[model samples]
Target: MTPSVQSVETEDEYIHVRFRDPDEFDTIRTPDWAAHAAQDVSEGSEVRTGKQKDSDDWEVQSVLIKKQVGEDKARDEAKQIVEKIES
Candidate 1:
């Protein structure tokens, strides 16, 4: 099953992926995926399941980084909403 990554933690020699599924996780030694997951986790992004390498192995296919809106942009949006409501 493709599980959403709930958390990523660094260990002595591995990166642990805690899945949203209860008690489901994987210790990864693959450097590429590990690094990607680490960055995504730090950025509060979503890590998507790529493919299953085998019965016991899976790969990270993509990282979905959440875009942070600027404070000015948010304020502008709020102003627009207020104007719309007043109209």
Candidate 2:
């Protein structure tokens, strides 16, 4: 099943991409791959996605972006990344 961004939140330099009832696409690999792909976005930016707690799911994740980037762009970028990865 395809996953959609359930919610998007922004912090100082981070964008959290939370999936809506994710299916098979939700795994350690999905977040790790996205994180790797996200880091290539810029020189200083970084991304992270993993289980904050062992009982939680990987669908809830976060990506760190450059401060100058807008939340809309960040979400769009994340959507592209997720689509590319899922395809």
* Best of the candidates, lDDT: 2
Off by over 4 Å in 2: 21-33, 40-62
**TM-score, one value per model:** 0.27, 0.52
Model 1 sits at a Cα RMSD from the real structure of: 14.0
70: Cα error in model 1, Å:
12
lDDT of 2 by residue, 44-79 (tens): 444444443445554434445555677777766666
The parts of candidate 1 lying over 4 Å away from their true place are 1-41, 51-54, 69-87
Candidate 1: worst 10 consecutive residues by lDDT? 77-86
Candidate 1 backbone clash number: 0
Give lDDT per model, in order.
Answer: 0.38, 0.54
